[model samples]
Target: MSELDALRERVVALERENDELRTPKRRRIRGRSVIGAVLLVLAVVLAPVAAMGTWARLQLVETESFVATFAPLASDPDVQDFVAEQVSAAIDEQVDVSAVVGEVFDGIRSLGLPPRADTALTLLEGPAADGAISLIDGVVHDVVRSEQFADIWTQSLRFTHDRATAILQNAPGTAVQLSDDGAVTIELGVVIERVKQAMSERGIGLADVIPEIDRSIPIAQADSLALVRTVYQVADIGGFWLPWLVVALVVAGVLLMRDRPRAVLWSSAAIALVFLLLSAGLGIGRGVFLRAVSPEIMSAAAATALFEQLTSLLAGTIAAIALIGVLAAMWAWLAGSSRAAAGFRGLVDSGFSAVRGAAERRGLTTGAFGRGIDRFRGPIFIAAVVVVTVLLIASRPVSFGSVIGAGVGLLVVAVLVELLRRPSEPKEMDVDPSADAATSTAQDPVSAPDAVS
Candidate 1:
């Protein structure tokens, strides 16, 4: 056993020696460079992702956009109904109508003047309960429709948008607030307090419960409270620097590569993959988020609509990033050895040449104008692509349709420009009469020297 252990140790030592002898001194440095290059590529790829996340958070938290996002909800029956239900539930928790009705029935039993009193109380129970429900619902409806309610809704939605998950994190204060650890909650308090006042005026006894209730409902939360903190941490940390750091790493990697174009192609492909993951991850997250908050608590449709709207910017940014990466990789590949890219380039060049030849035949290529057109044809086509891309980006929503439309539109513009750019050139064709006559005479037997002799 001792001999075997010694043999194993000697073998390990020999392998170590062999590795050092086989490896160049610079090999370690090369490995480090490769690792650094990879890290840089990741940084570059992640820059856009971080940018997307930051933009999403800003849209969700910013006042104007947040208001605009939910303003339409005021008119949406489904959304209004959802809000009414939440407020109604809150009121229910504060005012126990069932207990109130039970007490009235017990009082009739204590009176015991007649069996009719007990029976009368029994009949009143249903209508009384219905009347109470309708009154509270009316109060809620009035609150939901009022200008005051809209103001409250906007503030509450904005607050919830920013900090709904945080209180679940035990961050302090009510579930909804303007800032972390702030005591002031942007709850349905205004709406609820108003409803309580109205209900009190109607001689209902639930005004006291309204002030005592301080728990504001959250629009979003996670399974574990810790996860809610994790979200805030990630959003805060990744907000500005994560993407920039990624961009720096990618730039470093590309700069370090022996062949930059290939590096760009690979890096772009990697970026596309990352954005693809981001896009898919967003989808998966939507499901996870939906699972955490139930339809029983909030309307599933409204929740879905809200989630979709909030993440729309992120989705668009991801798609745009993916598209740009794909286009860059395609260009790099074309600049290298892709058959399709070569064919595309060939087709464009051939079109330009054909157009120039046709113009020349028509005497339109007789001057510097035509020469200039030929010289600038490539730039003109590229310029058209740039213009079209700008237009696509300027569009309100850059959908797949817009991308396809831009591609087709740019292709058409390039073809038309190549064909029609030099139409104003003169059509004069110059012919050499002396060469024509010499060629004709040489072909004639009578004009040939041997034939003449």
Candidate 2:
């Protein structure tokens, strides 16, 4: 009985040991799982922030490089200081990207138009080809007063295409005018013909007149103000946002077929930004407009009066139209599945049908005359209406009531043009129903295993 009791005690002791070992193993597994989950959560939370930080760093770096490279070309002390401040602010993380850009443009505004006199000339006595003595003067004069003389004199100079283009771009307020002497005009014509012949031999023409920098200077002086102007001009006239705009438009078009809501939002924003940037860049290049809200900064006062006068017209007319186009595109996107498109098509068809019914009911329909009138009358009437409207308004005495009436009339006209006018129907071949589906397939391709039995 004592031996039996000893065996039972031994078995119980072994069972207890086994339980202790199993408990620690289970605890270890639970700890490992908890650690893995924590690591996964950390990666998920930090990855996007890290990526954003990297992107911001890259942009900041690029902006810094540009600043450093173009530091010398800053003419205004205010601009230089502003640039420096922006750089410092960026480094300190005190301002956002948009704020930085605003500051830079504000600096640009500080660099206003060059001073002009009634007639200004800077003489250049330089070496001439073929051992011929040559004299050149960079001239700037008012278009009204000097137009005739400058025009004739320009022909007399027989300036090469390159030279002429250079004069046009750099010499602000320069205009070509007819010479006082008919004899001078004749001689100038002969000289120009000879130059044209020479240029033709060299495979050049008026169309080839691209303004380039004077590359004959020393390398150190290569980055001078003269060279910088060329850079700025090229950057300006090269359709500043053409490539980006096309890319955005294509992307938006592709996205339009899939996620229209997102596409409209993005595309509208991109178009608005591109237009504003291009306009502002052009204005800067041409030294046309500048802004000032502070007494210390008097840039707006010095900008071309002509530009200021035209600003209201430009902003109200052309800019407004572009903005409207963007809004329309966005609104169409908001109505997905081409429902907006169908609505527009129906609207156009309804208008034309109404017009046709009206003509039929009048019993005034003739074959050729009616068809011709139907085709041409709209445009002709529109043109006549526009002219008469303008003349009538202009002829009327100016008053607050007249101006208000004109504004109301104009608004009504615009609304009618947009909503009531019948647009030509688009051919069915223009849109491919399968393209959007194909694009989706391309983006997320079908697997061979999925297709297999």
Candidate 3:
């Protein structure tokens, strides 16, 4: 047999002999315990949610501008076409760009203008104006639904369109269209038609028309600084609770897996605290960046600005968290899996070992990427204590009871995690049956008498 095959065979024989040393039934029981352990984990995860009924609303409860904010994302034609089979499930009232196409036709008819466009306004805006078709629809809805002036506004809408078109036609540099390369075209028709179409379908009417008409409101003014700030604040507030819920859920999952009840309860609480600090740091960083960058612009209405900022920040945060956690977990796995390490070394000819040695020399090596470092544990513990002390000194500015409960709960969890973490199993002996046979022969030095017989 090849050397590799012989080595594998020897390893298997040793393992089987080792198995014989322990009762087979004990291993079988351990295998069964793993399945029971999984179910236990799921139960622990759901427990916190059950206890906090209303408090749990912090997790999935829609944000204040949820519909307005997300409406644009939901109405992408690409997304619509992709889900065409399920399009029937979408309510008709859902204002996709398709829905607004009819409105644009109506607006053209009202203006007594040709339906032909000099150039596509949407094309001019390109991807920048995506999902904003719904924002136009929203303004239309607001104008169309106004209880006091809806009728008057609807009657004047056509006249208002003509006037707005005229105003744009007269404005310098604003009337020229852009080329496919995003260059400005000399043709006024291209620019005018684009603005007319977006406005007409949007149902701008009296309420929304005046602001866009103010020539002083430059294109740059649309940046919406205040909105970014408000979004950051609202997100920060919601963020405070979000981490706690996530932590509780994760702890429950881990404990259920380990089948350690006491550990699960305590660990869940500790996880929540870590989540809080992480969330806060994220929120503060986001809020500061959005606010300090631009203070001059209105950024649209205050709430809209905030919602957009929050959405952008949240997207970035989620992606970062997912990527970093996966990489860290992979590093930890590589550090722990020596068998896998051996296989890797075989293929790479000790390249990884050399790199590790270099890293160790430079003080860049960690015992294991995630194992030894109390990253979440130490930072969270210190932060929690500081937050509590600050809150207490401020005459209980916040709910001390909740904070204390959460902190204590997390401490208990950290302790439980340390306790439940399984130690490395003792390595099996690399025994060969041949070796045993040879040893037996040597012990019976008087085997010469048996040979003579």
Candidate 4:
């Protein structure tokens, strides 16, 4: 073979070897990219689901949480009005006041009253019934608005919390009953009994005849209760595990990326976006719930109050999570290599240096303590972040206030770290003999050394 052909073959072999070396690396890169993408997408998609599941688990599975959540609804004016209206209507339905008054007029007519008197009695009947109804309504309102009623409301919810859970789980129960049309109503037997006793004390003669009846008020309703029950069941199971799963996926996804800080930044932003979308979905679901429940079943105000009160925990949870995501993204960006991040770090460092210089000029240096802090500032900062994050997550039903407090606390810690860090003093420079002699010669040219040729 010719030398040119041999050289060509050698070059071809080197090129083939280079291609073989690049192929595995390219495949590995592509595989890592695909895995990271899948994990991130899963985390983003399931974040809202995890949040909702946590809410449902807390509100349904934990009786105490459920009671704590709904107990406050007793003080809501809208809810009070709704209860009073339902109880009064229930009483009115049981005892027809107009009919009773008509019967009395009929008895009077049998005693040969004048024709004008009969017409007057007939004209007065409706107003008398209306006046009676107004009186009942007034009593009912007073009962519902009183502190005693609030206590009863709380106690009743606590007592029936288990039953409510059972109902959500599709278990048979009589304490908290579900109507055939998907209306979940609680029997206000205690409230009704109280109302009757109050009326009797007020000398309402009809109160003596008003029989003890089970008057149920619909609190929640849907077109398809079966779907709600199914969702609750699924949420009950997922609530226990989905949140952990989502967190694992997010961590895995971030760790898999070569640029972990940037991955974390994007992941946090995506999670926050998901939370915002979840919030919007809640608003839309509220509208849909209100529309689905007919006016005959529940008033708009009452329904709105119920929905808001019940979902308040969920809303707060979402807000706290979103805040955490935003804070994480902010931290990731601040720690990044971008120009903005570098500029911010520079500005902070300059400020710290200025403060330290001022303090040193005044002879108020941190001394050994500052040096120690400076030596371990990185660990201190990391510990602070970890503590704040753990506290935020460990809080039961995390609130916006808690999240904000944590963020503020972290900021304060960072500021303290910067303030406490003192740079070491610069040492004196050592001069080289040759350079020193050259400088001396340059300063005094007449004393320069002779050149050896």
Q: Best lDDT goes to which candidate? A: 4
Superpose all Cα atoms of candidate 1 onto the true structure and report the RMSD in Å to 1 decimal: 16.4
Scored by TM-score, the top model is 4
**Clashing residue pairs, backbone N/CA/C < 3 A, model 4:** none
lDDT by residue (tens digit), candidate 4, 1-453: 964454455556666887888787543466776698789889989988888888888876888898888889899998899888888888887888777777777898888888999898889878988888788789899999999889888887776666656777767545656544666555688898888888888998767766787877656556776776776678778887787788778878976787777888998999898898889998999999889764766788988988899999999999988988899899999989999999999998998999989988999888899999999998898798767755655565678999899889989998988887887878889999977854554444333333100
Q: List per-prediction Cα lDDT, in the order shown.
A: 0.66, 0.37, 0.39, 0.80
**TM-score, every prediction:** 0.59, 0.26, 0.25, 0.77
- lDDT per residue for candidate 1 within 1-453, as digits (tens), equals 664354455556666887899897663446656875777656665656575656644543355655676666666666677778878887788778767767766877887658877788887888887786787788888778777677777777666655644453456666444444333234666667777777787787745455555556554334554554565556656654555465557657766776666777978887777888889998999997677655655667777776787677668767876776787687678766667878987887787778778777977653665456657877887687657655754443345556666767766876665665553546888778976654454445343444224
**Alpha-carbon deviation at 377 in model 4, angstroms:** 2.2
RMSD after Cα superposition, model 2: 28.7
Taking the tens digit of each residue's C-alpha lDDT, what string does model 2 give over 158-262? 333223334425666556532222111112233223333443555533212322211110111123445544543544443223323333333335333335444
TM-score of 1: 0.59
RMSD of 4: 8.8
Per-candidate total of colliding backbone pairs? 8, 7, 11, 0
- Give candidates' CA RMSD values in order: 16.4, 28.7, 22.4, 8.8
Task: Give candidate 3 regions above 4 Å deviation.
Answer: 1-307, 332-342, 345-453
Q: What lDDT would candidate 3 get against the real structure? A: 0.39
lDDT tens digits, residue span 1-453, model 3 = 864454455556666777788756542445544654454444444333322322212212333233233334223333222222122112122334443554554564566544455234334343423445545434433432333222332223333333323332344544533222221111122222333344566564322322222111111121243443344345445444444454444434443443343333334343344434555665676566456443443222332344344345343333333332333244334434358856763655355445555665777644443333333545654465445434432331123344445446545654543332322336899889977764454444456235224
Where is model 4 poorest over a 10-residue stretch in terms of lDDT?
444-453
